[model samples]
Structures are given as structure tokens and as C-alpha cells.
Target: MRTRPIGPYGTAVSVIGQGTWQLERADRRTAVRALNTGIDAGMTHIDTAESYGGGAVEQLVGEAVRHRRHEVFLASKVRAANASAHGTVAACDRSLRRVGTDHLDLYLLHWPGGHPLEETLAGLRALHRAGKILHYGVSNFHDRHLAELFARTGPDEIVCDQVLHHLGDCSAELRVAPACLARGIAVVGYSPFGLGSFPPSPRAAAVLDSVARTHGATRHQIALAFLVREPHSFAIPKTATPSRAEENAAAAEITLSDEDIARIAAVCPVPADDGTPSSASGRRP
Candidate 1:
């Protein structure tokens, strides 16, 4: 797996990571095999959340990596409802327990809910001080949310943001990614396949098929390769099938040329190659 430093703070993760959403909701054996296979294929950064199957997926991740934890960069998240200082602490504690790890490589707030950011960050800092988490970030946050955060804390306090970014959605790139890149924070794209909920349009499908055929890979691999091409961007695609997990890991090896990236971007609505979004300052890292 190709690795990059996720943030200035020094967390190097695989450019193509593993997302374990609902990984253990059905057959426990299959879920464990997928996790293990992905890791074996050099999928080092594994992400999960408290709301993923009521924490069952975290347990599955724990079991899958119990013997090889050092080989993986583990990330987990707490729901927005638990954004309070005490709630955040308690939730992270449970996550650590479920994941069978004393400390998380990265911890995140699942979203910006009604809770006060100060209280939430205080709890996250508490975890950091106690060595329960190395870095803290957020998910599903836009530019305004990032503004609010930078207003209170230094820009570097948050290490990354995880968002739904795929062939059909470039919302994060338009609103969140430039802000993150400016501050030297990484952006991790989850649901690269749209959580199995979104299907590509015919035109987008054709674009992906064309790129995939050129690379001798599946369309899904082409879709994921687009995300990792962006500077300071990573992708974590989740699947409970072992074969699919292996395939997802292989996507990291398919390098798309500038033309392939631009063709996909034209169909996906991401900013033009001239710049990431609005200004020349948003250039890819």
C-alpha cells in the first residue's frame, strides 16, 4: 500500500484504507475474513464508528487485528449525540474497549450536532492527554463547521475530516476539502462506492468503464482511484466480502493519468484541474 502523512502531526496511512461499516451485521465469520484479508493485502488504515451496527463492527475489527494491531492504523468515531465532554469520554472509552486497543490512532466526532463544540473538543483533548487517542477530527462537516472550529482552536488541532465522496458526489470537495487542505489537514473519503446506496449515471459509468478498461481493472477500482489522486486525500471503501475487500485494496495500485482524472471530474462535478475550487490557493498538495 502507498502511504502518506495524514496530517502535519505525523500519521502515515495507506492511501486506500478500509471502512468497516456493518462489517459484522450478518455472518460473523465472513466479516472477520474480509477484515483480515484487507489487512493482509496492505490495507492499513481501518475506520469504524460507534453507530456501525451498534458497535458490533468495532468488535469484529478488534478480533481481526488483535494479533497484528501494529500493522494497521485504527480510526473510530462517536455519534454527534455523544459530543459532550463526559459523553465523548465515555463513548471513546467504550470504543477503545470494543476495538481492543488502549489508544486509537485517530478519533472523530461523527458530525456537528446540537452540542457545543467547546465541550466536545474538551473531551477529545482529554482523551489525547490521557493517550487514549493520538489525533481528533470530524466527519460530515462543511466549510462553516470548519470555520467555527478554527475560530476556537488553532487550525492544526483537527487532523482530518471524513466525508462521503464518490463518483456521484463531490460535495466535500466543493465545500470542505479546500478548507482542510489550506490548514494542512487531510481529507479522508468514505463510502467511495456510495455505501452501496448510490448508483452511477450511465455517462459516469461509461467514463469509469473507459478508465477501468485502460487500466485493466473494474469500474469500482477506477472510481476509487480518482479519489486518491487528489492531494491530501484518501479513500476508505467498505465491504463485508473478502474478495471485494481484496479488490478494493488493489485499487491503490491503479494510477490514473491527468486525463483520466479530468474526464471523471467533468462528470462528477469536482472543481476543474485549473485549481481545486475557487482560487489558485486551493491547488492540490
Candidate 2:
């Protein structure tokens, strides 16, 4: 699979990773098999959160990567409600225990919360100093959130910003993406398919169908490829089926043409910059 640099430190991560939003809802054997299959296929960046399935999914992820943890770039998130300095550290410890890992490759604040951003960054920095986490980031953060965060912390302290970026919504392109790119912070797109309501419009469906046929791929694969087409972008699509995991991983090999991107843009136009907030509805924290 193709890879991209995730931070200023030059950590390479697969363009297409694995998202464990609701993996706990899947059958135990199938979910484990799917995660292992993804890793075997080079989708080694597994993203989970302490809030997922009330932490049950983290245990499942631990089981899947138990023997091959060295082959994976493990990441997980701490909920907003637990963004306090001490709470952040405590939450990470619990996540580590559940995932059966001594340290996380990447840790993130699930979203903006009532707690001050300084406390969260202090907590993350403490973890970094303790070797409990290699890097830290944010998810569902918008332009203002990024501004506030950068004001309190150096750009190097942040590695990535995981947000809702899919074919249906490209609002992140307005400011969040540009700001991150300027700072060398990767934009890791989550829910690239958009609530399972993909090919949001007839025109989008037609464009996707044409592109998929041209590449001999499925619409889903085309969507994933499009999401990670840029060098600073990455994606984590969830799947509990081994075959689907393979399909998602294959998207990394696809190279969409300029014409193909233009066609997709025409059908699924990026929303105009009207100060509308990016969607943060998926994978609740």
C-alpha cells in the first residue's frame, strides 16, 4: 500500500488505514479476522477510541494485534469529557490496558470540550515525555479549534487532525486542511463514505460509476482513493469483513487522473466557504 508522512517527524502511515468506530458491534471472530486481514494487507494504522463500544472495541483491537503489534501503527482517542490534564493521562492508561499496549503511536483529543485546551496539551506532552505515546493529535477540530490549539502549542506537538472528509463533504478544504498542511500536520480523513449514504446524489453516483469502471474498482474503493488522493491526506474506513478490508486496502494503489478528479468535483461540489462548521456527527466520543 502507498504511505504518507503523518507528522513533522516523518512517520510513514498507510494512505488507507483501519477505523474501529463500531467494530464491537460485529461478530467477534469476523471482526478479529477483518482487522488481522487489513494488517496483513498493509492497512496497519489501526484507529480506535476509548469511547468506542464503551472500550470493548479496544479489547478486540488488542486481541487482533496481540501477536503482530510490531507490524501496526496503533492510534486511539480520549473523549472530550475526559480532556482534563489528569483525566487525559488516566484515560490513556485505561486505553493502553484495553489495547494491551505499553505505548500508542498516536493519541488524540476526540473533540473540543468544556476543559481548556492547555490542560489537554499538557497531558499529552506528559505522556510523550513518559514514552506512553509517540505522538498526539486532534479529531473533529475546525478552523477556530486549530487556531486556539496552535496558539497554546507548537505545530510540532500536533501530528494529525482526523476529521469528517468524504466525497459528500469537502468543507475541510476551506481552512482546516490548508492550515494543517502549512504546519506539516497530516489530515487523516475519517468516515470517508459519509454515514453509509455514499454517492450522495445521482450525478455523484454516475461519476463514481464511471471512475470505478475505468479503474476496475468498486464505487467504495474509488471514494476511498479520492479521499486520500492528496499527499497530506489519509483515510481510515471501517470494515468487519475480510473481503471488504482487502477491497479498502486496494484503494491505495489506485491513481485517479486529473480528469477523474474534476469529474467528481463537478458532481459533488465542495461547499462554498460560508463559515459553516465541518460535520462531527460520526463515531461519537
Number of the predicted model whose lDDT against the real structure is largest: 2
lDDT of 1 at 115: 90
Q: Which residue pairs show backbone clashes in model 2?
A: none
The TM-score obtained by model 2 is: 0.97
lDDT of each: 0.84, 0.91
In candidate 1, list every pair of residues with a backbone clash.
Answer: none
Name the best candidate (by TM-score). 2
**lDDT, candidate 1, 1-285, per-residue tens:** 778889778777899989887666658888888888999998989999888888888888899999999898999998889889999999999999999999999999988864999999999999999999999898877766788887877766888988878877677787678888988889998878774534468788888899889999999888888888876999998888899988999999989998998898887886445543332121110
Stretches of model 2 off by over 4 angstroms after superposition: 275-283
Assess the local accuracy of residue 255 in candidate 2 as a C-alpha lDDT between 0 and 100: 97
Model 2 Cα lDDT, one tens digit per residue, 96-207:
9999999999999999864899899889999999999999999999877988888988858899999988888887777888999999999999888887788788889998
Error of 1 at 268 (Å): 1.8
